[model samples]
Target: MKTELVQTFGSRFERSLIEEIADIGTWMEVPAGETLMDIGNYIRQIPLLISGVIKVLREDEDSDELLLYYLEQGETCSVTMSCCLGQSKSEIRAVTETDATIVMVPVQKMEEWMAKYKGWRSYILESYHHRLNELLHTVDNIAFKNLDERLMEYLKKKSEISEDNNIRNTHQEIAVDLHTSRVVVSRLLKRLEKMKKLQLHRNYIQILDL
Candidate 1:
């Protein structure tokens, strides 16, 4: 667990800080294709991803839609400030894309830590900053980026996690992330595959080139 925390947050802290959190929380495993959070759910808890990935999604009023974004290890599902400040009920839907393990921390326990641990406060502040930056980036991209560029950028980020360039993601998922139609994503992916830039297997994709 200490090793996982270091991998996520970097080794700027002594091991004791991570050990403190690990001591309290038991690991929970979530199977793929299960919904971890639904619309209008309480936000009094956050899960620390330890393995595999989860997809954060929200659907339109029609309910025949999805907004998919990959939430990998180390990313918290609950946006802490929103929940802490008593904002709207969380609209985000958290669904596991792969079998996953997460350490769930209740809000009350988090508050206690925030009050007691000076170093932990710094960690939370850093997390807030990073999350804010990411949100800003998402906003900027949606306003200015084209679908192709967004898809390419997503692939690039995914490639970093998977050294072999394997991006085991679906076109429908990519469509949601890019805010485009699945047909468009499918067409583009087919072109890329034909160019020999990637290998497409059942429910998985691997980038052979850039």
Candidate 2:
């Protein structure tokens, strides 16, 4: 476990911090599409991603979901940190985008490490700053971009994160993530197909223009 931690985050974090994580953190291999955290759930552990991608989402009262951003290799969710410190339920949802190997650090150790390790404190603060910028970008897309423009951005980001031009998400799934109606997504997709931006198939979409 320590070997894995060292390989993933050895240089980024201090030697002592890595040792502590290996000692206390529960290593997990979570599969794709699994919901690791959800709205209103009390977070017990903070995930330190070793490989693969985890997408963070936000939901409304009616269960409509909007894609916020992604947690990639060597990254942790700052929103999870906030919930851990506040001792409150999670405000966002975290789902595995691919088969993911992660170390689940117990929330209890956060404060101790913050005061003990200067490196740990710096890393946490940097993570918060990174996530804040992503959240702001999401807001800008919603407020400034048209629906079609937003859809393009979403499609590009999906391809980048999935590392594939062939997107497997269904129309309804895309609609949910975009916080729009399925009909709207379908209509726009058809237009994009005709424009040679993408090629649609049953249950999959082949993006021509990223």
Candidate 3:
């Protein structure tokens, strides 16, 4: 795990900082579909993804979750940073989109590193900026785009992140992510099929084109 972290970010950080991370970070493996964090919970550790993908979501009072963005290999969760900095409870959720390996650093170390390491500070700021932009894009899609367009955008994003156009998700699952009904998703998906943008199977969607 130390070697992996060094390989990932060693060039940007000092050897002493990397050594400290290795000593303090604990490796963890998370299976697909598992919830890594939940709303209103306090985060005690911050994870640096080593492999696979994690999806960050925001849930409403009714427990409807909307997909915010994905954290992939070599990325960290920005929301966790916010929680650590403020010592507040999480307002979002993080679920493993695929089987993932991560290194968890104690929350106290996160703050300490931010003050002690220039590289760590830059990484945190970059993570926050990236996540904020992603959330803003999500908001724009929801506020200005129709359901069909949003659904298409969501599918495209999933395909891009997963590095596969064959999306193995049901209409109901898609609806849940988009915060809509299955019927609506099915209807738009059918339209997409008719337009030859994608092909629908029983349990998956295959993109034929954009």
Candidate 4:
């Protein structure tokens, strides 16, 4: 894990900072479908992803969740940083989309690193910018785009993150992410199938073209 961290961030950080992270971080492996963080919960540690993908979701008052963005290889969760900095309960949730390995940095260490390491501060700032832009794009999609367009965009994003156009997700799951009824999702999916944009199977979607 130490070696991996060095290889992953050595170019961006000083050797001393990298060594400190390796010494203080705890390694964890999370299984797919596991929830890493939950709403209203206080977090003591933040994860630096080593492998696989994590899905960040924002929940509403009614407990409905919207898929926000993904944390892929070599990425950190911006929401986790926010919570750690403010010492506040989490407002969003993070779930492992695939079997993943992460380095858990204690909140104390995170705060220390932010103050002591230039690279750490830059990484956090960059993460915030990237995720904020993604969330804004999500908001734009929801506020201005039609459901079909949103569905297509969602499929494309899932495909990109998974590195496979063969998406192993059910219509119901997609509907939940899009905040719509399963029946409506099924209907639109059928239309997409008829249009030859994709092929729908029992529990998966195969992108034939786009």
Q: Each prediction's TM-score against the native?
A: 0.77, 0.95, 0.96, 0.96
C-alpha lDDT of residue 28 in model 4: 90
The runs of at least 3 residues in candidate 1 whose Cα sits more than 4 Å from the true structure, single-residue gaps closed, are 1-20, 64-69, 78-81, 193-203
lDDT of 2 by residue, 88-158 (tens): 99999999989999999999999999999888888899999999999999999999999888887788888
* Weakest 10 consecutive residues of candidate 1 by summed lDDT: 8-17
Regions more than 4 Å wrong, model 2:
none
Q: Number of clashes in every candidate structure?
A: 0, 0, 0, 0
What is the lDDT for 204 in model 2?
Answer: 84
Clashing pairs in 1: none
At residue 128, give the lDDT of candidate 2.
96
**lDDT value for model 2:** 0.91
Superposition error at 2 for model 4 (Å) = 1.2
lDDT for model 4, on a 0 to 1 scale?
A: 0.88
Query: TM-score of the candidate numbered 1?
Result: 0.77
Residue 157, candidate 4: C-alpha displacement in angstroms: 1.3
Q: Which pairs of residues have clashing backbones in candidate 3?
A: none
Give residue 192's lDDT in candidate 4 (0 to 100): 86
Per-candidate alpha-carbon RMSD to the true structure: 3.3, 1.2, 1.2, 1.2
**Cα lDDT of model 4 by residue, 87-123, tens digit:** 9999988999999999998888877888998998898
